[model samples]
Target: MKILVTGGAGFIGSAVVRHIIKNTQDEVVNVDKLTYAGNLESLVEVSDNVRYAFEHADICDKEAMERIFAEHKPDAVMHLAAESHVDRSITGPAAFIETNIVGTYVLLEAARAYWSGLNEAEKSSFRFHHISTDEVYGDLPHPDEHPASAELPLFTEKTAYAPSSPYSASKASSDHLVRAWLRTYGFPTIVTNCSNNYGPFHFPEKLIPLVILNALDGKALPIYGKGDQIRDWLYVEDHARALYTVMTKGKPGETYNIG
Candidate 1:
């Protein structure tokens, strides 16, 4: 299969690209804007592979995205490009809104156009996999907040959308757009909302890497509000595998909560 992965230079996106290039026979075309968080250095291991290709392009650019679709003729798309930092989103929401919401909208259109041009068999197998976060479900009840005897549940596939931060809200909006395209246009789209990911080559702005890097340097670890916010953590490699499994084997027009 020929797959196009947006934001393939970032943490999780790079993981996905590496998994595809190393473990599978599929070819990957990575489309990334190369933002501060999106570093090409993350994909150094797989960069030399014949199955892997990188494009320094933003998903928000409609013309460039269209050209990419025509040029690569990808069989599937894994949409992951966005401004993902919650603190950054709180300070500057415009980037999150533009990149997450508007960018996803544009990518969906571009992918749909490409999918429409395929043959019946290719169209049936083509997929638009929108990768999103579990933060879109808002804050789950932590065990510390309640008694240890009380049931602390995980975010399920049916969890209601209650995004608190701008970043999560933008992701929620993109998820909706992806679903809308599937429902209205018969596009073969699948949405996956996963837990927090932490692993190698992670950007320094995020909590896990920041904590580890700061602790090593004897710098203060900035905990948000007494270090009580709990999140379901998944290793980046684990997430990439789960995403690939779902994309290749998932049912059309169905939402799978991959964590």
Candidate 2:
């Protein structure tokens, strides 16, 4: 299959691209805007592969999305483009809203149009896999906030939306748009909410990479709010594999949680 992956130059997206190019017989069209967090160097390993193709375009550009769909005729789409940093979102939310919410809507419309033109067999085999974050479920109870004997809850597929930050709120909005497309238009869509991811090629802006870089430079590490907040960290490679599984085997109109 030829899959188009948005944000394919970003950490997790690059991992997914490399996974497909190196491990599968599938072809990949990497559509990324090359934002500060997106480093094409992360994809160096697979960039030279015949199965890998790259397009530098913003997801919010409807014309660009339409052109891409028409040119690539992708069998599946792994949507991952977005403004993802909480700190950045707190200071400037417009980019988050524009990229995460509006961008998703544009991509969905483009995919719907392309699918509408496909043959019945091709349409039935196509998938639009929406990648999301666990933050949309809002903050979980920290150990400091509850007794040791008390049961702690994990974010599940059925978790209710309660986003606390602008970034999460934008992602939550996109998630809603994806489901609405499925229910209202019979779009072949799947959503997956994943926990924190840490591994190779992670941008230095993120916590794990920042801490490692700072420690290497003999600088002090910064922690948020006494360092008591908890997170479930999933390796980037594992997250990539899980996404591929969902893209290929998951049921449309279904949601999966990966950690």
Clashes of each: 0, 0
Each prediction's Cα lDDT score?
Answer: 0.91, 0.95
Scanning candidate 2 in windows of ten residues, the lowest lDDT window is 139-148
Which candidate gets the maximum lDDT versus the true structure? 2
Q: Against the hidden reference, what TM-scores do the models get?
A: 0.97, 0.98
Off by over 4 Å in 1: 147-150
Native-referenced Cα lDDT, model 2 = 0.95
**Candidate 1, run of 10 with poorest lDDT:** 141-150
lDDT of 2 by residue, 138-224 (tens): 988877778888788788889899999999999999999999999999999999999999999988889999999999999999999
Which residue pairs in candidate 1 collide? none
* Error at 2, model 2, angstroms: 0.5
